[model samples]
Target: MGSKNISITEDAYERLKAHKREGESFTDVIVRLTEDERDIMSGFGAWSGTDKGDHARKAREQLNAEFEDGR
Candidate 1:
């Protein structure tokens, strides 16, 4: 694999260092943090199968009523 040298401010460097585990490199910490974020949406697509559709419809009706009342 190829590599590049990037620079960060002291504050940014400290933040990354804080996230690094024992014996882990900055690259590892960054990859771990980013990969963790990707898993967030893994089950979000299943929302339609739950009560989310009904909840959304009810919320929309409530919002519409509030808007009509304000008019």
Candidate 2:
């Protein structure tokens, strides 16, 4: 793999470094900071229709029931 070199300001470097976790590289920090965890397509439809799917379905049903009962 090839790497690219880019220049960042002193404050930018410090901020990026502040987000660095133990055992994580600068690239990891950049990706974690830049990637949108809430993007539907990113993790959407990736469930295997097992544990998580079952729980979410149950939660939705419970929530709907609560609203229906006005509780």
Clashes (backbone N, CA, C under 3 Å), per candidate, total 0, 0
The lowest-lDDT stretch of 10 consecutive residues in candidate 2 is: 43-52
lDDT by residue (tens digit), candidate 2, 8-66? 99999999999999999999899988887686656654667744577678889999999
TM-score of 2: 0.49
- Could you tell me every candidate's TM-score relative to the true structure? 0.60, 0.49
Q: Give me the runs in candidate 1 sitting further than 4 Å from their true place.
A: 36-52, 63-71
lDDT of each: 0.82, 0.86
Q: Candidate 1, residues 1-71: lDDT per residue as tens digits? A: 88889999999999999899998988989889888555665665376545556776887899999999995
The alpha-carbon lDDT assigned to residue 15 of candidate 2 equals 91
Worst 10-residue lDDT window, candidate 1: 43-52
Candidate 1 positional error at 1, Å: 2.3
For candidate 1, list the clashing residue pairs, or say none.
none
Best by TM-score: 1
